[model samples]
Target: MRGEAGLPPVDMSVKVGPLALPSPVLVGSGTFGFGEEYAPYCDLARLGAIVTKAVTLRPREGNPGPRIWETAAGMLNAIGLQNPGLERFLAEKLPPLVAAGHVVIVNIAGHDVEEYVKLAGALDAAKGVAAIEVNVSCPNVSRGGIEFGRDPAVLGELVRAVRGATRLPLIVKLSPNVSDIVPLAAAAMEAGADALSLINTLLGMAIDARQRRPRLANVTGGLSGPAIKPVALRMVWQVWQALRPPIIGMGGIMTGEDAAEFMLAGAAAVAVGTANFVDPTSASRVAAELEDFCRGQRINHVSELTGGLQV
Candidate 1:
């Protein structure tokens, strides 16, 4: 038991190929700021990793106003991958976050494969980027968005190019909006991916019948939070069984039980996304509950439960 630190004795250290995480509760890419915004609400070091909001080659002003839509069990957002781009991130945002002890990861988006490679190379040299989460899967925005993630060929080539660019471990986030995940997962592995993170938010929308307008100004946004948990779980289980690489799973996980189910299904770690926006303490609570679960189950290390299900 790690005493006085609110950590349990389960020893939840996880390794993604060569990268390591302290716990299984990682804050999701788009929802969590560059490991800074959540600082006031959380002990950033307590997380498995902190994935910054999706960063692009050039700074983004993000989508037009009214980008969020609230629903019964979740939220839909088309934040449009708002970021300060690589140069500004390195110069202005990254240093303090990492120095504060958060395990830093740069989540990168690109308009093309070459852009990904360039950003990867840049982050590889930037101070304190522990890893790179390739977001070739976001579907909310237009342009070279979900196209790269849906096709196995494009996915493979893009991953290979970025893999070639950085010395840091690669975690390619996969979109669930695909016909089949196996081929794409296979393509990523063959392209030198060190790890795989699955189930970027599914495409969804809400409408105001009276006003005859979409709730979100973007019309369609990526769905996340409680409502998508089942879909996320099924995809994580399928990809975990199909692909041999270590997996980081996420979708609608808001509770410790939700997080634990993903772990049982084969996720090496779970990212708590939409819940962060709903309940700032959601991630921390899940982490606590997971530790309690391991204790009750008599498991010493959380890694022992990784893909532990028997076929």
Candidate 2:
């Protein structure tokens, strides 16, 4: 398995629960659009997986003006989960992705338990959907976003409902705005989640000091990028220690070293988020860099990096 540049043969494939990824790097939902938005800039099929934007039961116009605000090391977004709904995604967006031979993971959000179940069942019949990332934590939405995610009972119920709906690999995406993430992580797993993705943006806001107003129309938005790396890493590490499920660590993953750090912190895989907005090919590049990282460390398989942290 000698890699490109004739370095030591390194294996990047990882088992994300029942899903086997060819690489440890994946594109985070929302940031990568419908998994094809960045295809013009990079090869979507090259990455381990692509998590599509938050798909809902109906179309949403998203939030009002100034949905995104740039900060020091990160950005705040209150996109409001605007999407073309399931029918449109299945009819128009999904075909090209499946045709491109890429591993597609559809991420869905809902205002209630039944919505999640319904959406899951709908995506189940899609041809190329490799998995479903349940977005229980979305700061942008008002009804069923972070509200359901913060409550262990609600989160468990939602996971269970969605689990019963689809046979696709279910990955519960957890929120970071909770007091104890361990319980929530355990709840999802106990309710029958095959995998987990952690730190789906922290609740944050930016104030326009000059105008004496909020930077974003939604006032508070989900914070992501380098600023949230430490928080994301800590949560992923805690969840991995507690649940030991296949975890996809995301939030502030911008480079290959960052992705490697997530794996070392106990993530089976890592997703590129805000970095995609900065560089469309970030995910693919991270995958390549991870291979070089393994070769440099004399590690033959990338899976060895999971929970490899000495401390």
Candidate 3:
């Protein structure tokens, strides 16, 4: 098919393991609500997928007031996995996105292995779910409330158990708070994760010097946005070099060039997170911009940009 200005269409389709996405640009979970909320501002179908916010077994009230604080070129959030829980999500959230023909990748979190198993099993039968993204950044109550992604063993066990519960493709979202990300990425892959999502916000804190208090009520929150882009890119490069697992790269991506940077570093797909807050149409815009980038580079397929970075 011919593209804009009589140029040949740049193939934008990508396969993150078993999941085939029409575009490489996906709106990150928690940033884009269940998918329908941004319909008026952007075309949901034009994007790769809509990764829904983290859902747990039970409803969570999230964190106290001032859960979000804006910082230099980024933002800190301790939303505490706030959601309406599984039942409501399957009933209320999933249907609308599916009805709208949006590829829905549900992000799930839990306090322990059993909860994750239960969630995976439940979602296995839920129609319209394209895949399940295991958010290992959540606390594991059985492990003294430490984040599941912090330990390679714990993350592997979690992924293994979830893998057994469902036949759906599994995407493990890794935390960037670790000392080295390669071990955790290897563990997830060995445990049967079909794809990996890297650098899920770095741990950070913002203090109010004037009030001598923390800016966020949670004291510390996940830091995201342009400030973390370099770190995210590095991690993605390291993991890809070591394991080469299908990766969904994210962190401070605000434009097409940013997405291209991640792809060059070996991300099979890129997700837009913090940028959504600034522009609800950011995801769709990024997709278009990525196509423009591909055309400008004389690339025939977007996949050609994957791991194309030179030393």
Which one wins on TM-score?
A: 2
Residue 217 CA error for candidate 1 (Å)? 1.8
Cα lDDT for residue 31, candidate 1:
83
Better of 1 and 3 by lDDT: 3
The whole-model C-alpha lDDT of candidate 1 against the native structure comes to: 0.85
What are the runs in model 3 whose C-alpha is more than 4 Å off? 139-146
Question: Candidate 2: how many backbone clashes?
Answer: 0
* Cα TM-score per model: 0.95, 0.97, 0.97
Identify the runs in model 2 with alpha carbons over 4 angstroms from their true place. 1-6
Model 1, runs deviating above 4 Å: 1-8
The clash count of every prediction, one per candidate, is 1, 0, 1
lDDT of 2 by residue, 1-311 (tens): 34657666888889999999988888888998987668889766569988899999998889997999999899999999999998999999989888988889999999888888999999997788999999989988788678888889988988988989999999999999999999999999999999999879999999989999999999999999999999999999988887788999998988778988999889999999999888878888888888888888889999999999887
What tens-digit string does per-residue lDDT give for candidate 3 at 195-286?
Answer: 99986888898998999999988888888999999999999999999998999999999999999999999999999999999998899899
Worst 10 residues of 3 by lDDT: 137-146
TM-score of 2: 0.97
Name the Cα RMSD for model 1.
2.1
